[model samples]
Target: DAGVTQSPTHLIKTRGQQVTLRCSPKSGHDTVSWYQQALGQGPQFIFQYYEEEERQRGNFPDRFSGHQFPNYSSELNVNALLLGDSALYLCASSFWQGYQPQHFGDGTRLSIL
Candidate 1:
């Protein structure tokens, strides 16, 4: 089965600009969660989407937003990006939900210039 997928394995952007990353959840998953992973650090949850609505949010600011499509795909949008926003954007999904172990894609490596 097709697993989670992300686009633009690497990207470069400047400060104050905006960037949008894409993700496709694993087969049979209904929930999508976005996360940010800094160099050498664990993934930090940004938010989660279920039923086309954001179900949970993390410590990130409002500038970080996301959406989940009916096909179980997801997208992460970061506006007014900053140098600090440079990190790996990851999308993970679970089969049953309720905090189950999620499978991760390699991620989109975003770099702020």
Candidate 2:
């Protein structure tokens, strides 16, 4: 009965530092996707992972990477972070190639200080 969950509800970091965000899939979900949302903007797809492999990616640069564990949990990593990177990072979980509805976590608010 668990839903999607993300860690470090809030985070503060400096430009050029690396950060890792984590997520746990909702019950019965097998795919995990990451998104970034800036103030006043809609979420932008970052990438998605399934079966321990990246099945799809957005226009984001290589600096954005992720991993899907055997248990369906996921981790998103941002390297050489920049001020523009400060935003709400969201994780969503879905099943069957995203044909089913996705459940999202509350999101992690990241601030570049």
Candidate 3:
């Protein structure tokens, strides 16, 4: 079965450009959650989408937002990116709520250049 997938495995951008990262959920799964992991840090929840609605959000600012399509794929959009925003964008898929241990992809390594 196809597992969770992310695009542009690595990216380098300036300090003030908008970026969009993509993800496709695992086979037969319906939930997607986005996380930001800074260098040497644990993953921080950005937001989660289920049933085409944003079910939960983290402490991030408005610049961080996401959308989940009916097909169970998702995208993370970041506007006016900052140098500190550079991190590994991880996409995880679960069968349902946060109670389950999620399966994660290697993630897209975003670097602010």
Candidate 4:
């Protein structure tokens, strides 16, 4: 089966612009998590979704939002983007069972100007 997939591998946005990145989880996965990775830094957890609801969130501000559909695909939406928001957005998916390891997609590279 195909692994997780992310869209628009690269993007450029001006400050204050809004952007949405998409992801599709691997087959049979029921949970999706989003992360932001700045240059040279490890991925920082943003949020997680299961059963179409957000189950957890990190320290990110409200400007960062997301949704998961019944099909297990997901989207990460960022509003009023800032230069600091430029980073690689990663999506990982796994079963909702306890301690399941996540499978990640090739991240979307977002650049703010």
lDDT of 4 by residue, 1-113 (tens): 99999999999999999999999999999999999999999999999999999999999999999999989999999999999999999999999999999999999999999
Point out the higher-scoring one by TM-score: 1 or 2.
2
Q: Give the alpha carbon lDDT tens digit for every residue of 9-105 in model 1.
A: 9999999999999988889898889899999999999999888899899999999998889888889999999999999999998764476888888
What's the CA RMSD of model 1 in angstroms? 1.1
What lDDT score is found at residue 35 in candidate 4? 99
Residue 77 displacement in candidate 4 (angstroms): 0.1
| TM-score computed on alpha carbons, candidate 1 | 0.95
Worst 10 residues of 1 by lDDT: 93-102
TM-score of 4: 0.99
lDDT of model number 1: 0.91
Candidate numbers sorted by TM-score from highest down: 4, 2, 3, 1
Candidate 3, residues 1-113: lDDT per residue as tens digits? 99999997999999889999999999988999999999999999999999989999999999998999999999999999899999999999998945787888789999987
Best candidate, TM-score: 4
Question: Tens-digit lDDT track for model 2 on 9-105?
Answer: 9999999999999999998899999999999999999999999999999999999999999999999999999999999999999995536877899
- Model 2 bad stretches (over 4 Å): none
After superposition, the stretches of candidate 4 with alpha carbons farther than 4 Å from their true spots are none
- Ten consecutive residues with minimal summed lDDT in candidate 2? 94-103
